[model samples]
Target: MNFRKVRHVVRREYLESVRKRSFLLGLVATPLMMGAMIFLPFVSEGLVSQEEMRVSILDRTGRYGAALIADASPDLILTLAPPGMAEEELDARVAAEVLTGWILIPEDFAETGECTYRSGSITNLAVLESLRTRLGLSLAGAKAQELGLPSEDVESLLRPAEMRTVRVGHAGAREGDFTQVYLRAVMLVMTMFFALIPTGQILMRSVIEEKSNRVIEVLLSSVTPLELMVGKIIGLGAVGLTLLGAWASVGVLLSLRLGTSLPISGGEIGMFVLYFLPGYFFFAALLGSIGSICSAERDAQPFLMPISLTLILPVMMGMAIAQAPDHWVARAFSFFPPLTPSLMLFRYAIKEPPAWEILATWTTLVLATIAMFGVSARVFRVGILMTGKRPTLPEIARWARER
Candidate 1:
């Protein structure tokens, strides 16, 4: 608890991290990757992309169906079916792979216009819909002209009505960020994916490096158990923060330059910093405490995996959370401390949840962080010095209670 010791540990952790190669590489690489992801949409869009499709037509109305093909597009190559060719024949061609797809003009073509598409290989659902819609409209327009009605009027009647919706909270919200909300949810998931594994790994390796060489003996001789425990937490935390900041900055800059600048506010960034700090510190302390309790790296798997999986669940359900932040499952986890800060922070940042909910989420996590650190500090102090014995949860609790 000494200010001098805490300060000394913080400084030592920071220096050790600055000297590591992993930290340096992360700082440089994160921004570039982010930039690339951001600009990729702009760079890759509308670039001669086609499905490599060739289409054919069996026209019962002869003129109407052939006209539909000619106007289809540069992408669609419509070949004329020979006279007396049957519907079965066109179906056979599709099955034979002679055509990518075909639009069948039924024999009852003049009386009713129900054109169907036939393909052996699956048509891209989107492309199929486009063909059906465009071709249908083209046929309908030609029929309307024969009946002395404007093709435009018929099309207008069939068009979907445009709508405008309003949300009650957070001014300046946009429709585009619906995708972004889902995307940020995705990013939140991926960030945790990238983060928890490596961070836990670093914790494991740090423990192994110290344990394998008996580095603990040298440090234990000079510092108290509390100082060593706190030192490792602060040190690894600095490394995590440095890497996170680098990755974030990279992603942000790249998005701004190359990708869509998803309408993120200062509050969202602050929530990320605030929530990530607790979520990560909570896990880091948990992991570091585990590392301290174990004599070997392999020993950590028993404890670490359960905790790791619990945190990973929210990230896995990220899309579901984004779609419905107020869903019972999402809301329930928002209150659970281990999942709260990351999952809720992602939800809150994207949608800007109710003020009371945001306040509760932050407050609960902050309290949990304090409580965890206290217990971890005690377990670390008692266990770090004790060798060949792993402490249980009851032992950590009893040690904290006695301390």
Candidate 2:
């Protein structure tokens, strides 16, 4: 292999990609899009109308109606229904938008605790939850009064305890914020997906275009297929790293300006890099091989789908893995080479796994990446100049096995 030729190829690939308008736009747009996705819900919540919910109570037992009206919050306009008012009347009131909902407390309330809430639309979870909570507290107080407990003691007994969580770690103890940990894990996984998949596709498309244009023939005059492949991977991988670095810098600046600490630690960031590089190389080599065999983008999709699914499945299961980092399924998947990057990152975010497990997964991923690169190089060497029909699986396997 001529190192000089490889260097030239790497320089050319890097310069060509970084100079594109799309790449320039992506550097600014990607972070803004991710920021909007993260914070938009909170902004939307603030925009929600603070209209008071008008509700009526049809208390058949005649015991809890006055209590509900008294305990209702400022946002709730609660009123007792007229004596002997039919269920149809309440439904009509809801349909007319005269009431947000109507609560039915049955006559045998002392024996059966079931109640029904009827509304035209049941999608307002906040209002539903508030009503359920207040109703439950009111029922508990009524039962306490029946048991001859003092009113003041009932209030004290029904009050919820305030609790705080402290997470003890190697660095010492700090207040635990599950939301921060969850968001950090999601961000890390998304970062890997954005950095790896698109860059890999770019590599694949570059290879296909070069092959289709017979440009590889000219390049081969100076560099071996292995050199060309390695150079392209390194150059594009550098592009991905540049993107990650830019995002990380922006995140650090924002966190500093906002007087907030980063949710991720230095060690976790190091692990992320370790997993990220091999994961990129593995997929890049796979995509590069697929690109080598095909003449067009359409021809590549059949091969690309499985690889795409492998990356996506881990993300879909991310919540489960984070919730139970030490579960057998998560632990087992952490050792699987294709899933190691995302699943292991999730586990690390929730709870750092054993050192040997991390080392084992990392080693496995590195070995898989090297093996994949070697196979891809052989396939590329054979298929780069082939131009007629797309090769079969067996033919591709034969290419990899050949000298």
Candidate 3:
């Protein structure tokens, strides 16, 4: 109820957090790390030494081995291995640093056309795909030229061609691109990953300290339990915002340095911050509630495990949705409250969600945040004074539902 007190507390919390060495280091380091994460890959791709990628092929197809090499890019190195060489020998070659990897075209490979790979190391997928595609094109071109017969027809067969790809949804609706949906999912999930754990730790530490030092008793005198809870949530919530803002500023600077465009707009950033604040407030309240219900840090374990579990779900969902953004299963995670912010962010980043879905998702989230606060406040009120024993679920429920 005291604006002055809230402001005072908020100022103190912000100042203290900003003064921490970790915060300072983050402010300085985040930009550089972000820059590297953005710039290095592109830089590597463009400016990397034009050393060829040598892939050895043991061919079963009498006519196809040379065709694959001819079709490859100038940067590719295609070597032919003699027949009867064991894969172990090839691996030894790689181990001895004489070769990178090899592919085997078995005796039946000419008929079935399947390829086998032997390697001491996992190769870059892009490189593998490129080799396979170029080889296929070269062999196809060879066959076409052979069929064309005359020199003039062979020239025609060599002409460059273009192709366009389109994917249709279930209704045959032209889903031009659902990548926005994908980007949104990726961003949201990543944001949560970077946001939740540290923020939750802040909440837990705040509660544990208060419980240990008995400061909650004094604070409860001046402000009601609800006020104290809200203040802590707001205070720590601001810290999370500050950390995210610093990280984002560094990201922007790095992107600029790297000449990489950030997919998020000012409007999107504002929306994300908007969503993130409420989401953290919600989770902070839950974590603080758990922390309050415990008598000591040791007692916080059983209570803390569920928060850990809740955190894990979204990461699990992120892995699943990365492959198929439009899958109903992915959509279901987007609506799940614990995972919603991350999943929704990813969805929005990849593609703008229909207005109704966005509205409905947050509407549910806000309601949940409100309920969590209520439960948190009760546990904080009852468990603040009690010590020596962690409150059981029934006790926490009773305290929360107390008249």
TM-score per candidate: 0.80, 0.92, 0.78
Regions more than 4 Å wrong, model 1 = 28-49, 60-64, 86-97, 108-116, 135-148, 159-171, 175-178, 192-197, 251-263, 302-309, 389-402
Scored by CA lDDT, what does every candidate get? 0.70, 0.85, 0.68
Candidate numbers sorted by TM-score from highest down: 2, 1, 3
Q: Over the stretch 1-403, how does candidate 2's per-residue lDDT look in tens digits?
A: 7888889888988899999997888789887887686567757755542677889999998988898899777777999998599999899999999998999999887677889999877877778888888878888889999999999999999997889877565555667777667777777777777788878998999999999888999989878999999999999999999989998998899899999987678767988898999999999998998899999989998777777777656667867876777899888888778888877887777778888999999999999889998899999999898997998889999999998
Q: State residue 86's C-alpha deviation in candidate 2, in Å.
A: 1.8
CA shift of 197, model 2, Å: 0.7
Write candidate 1's Cα lDDT for 101-206 as tens digits: 7777776766776777778755266677777777666766777778887767876855757776433346564555455455555455446545555665676567
Q: Which one is best on lDDT?
A: 2
Q: Pick the candidate with the highest TM-score.
A: 2
Stretches off by above 4 angstroms in model 2 are 38-52, 168-174
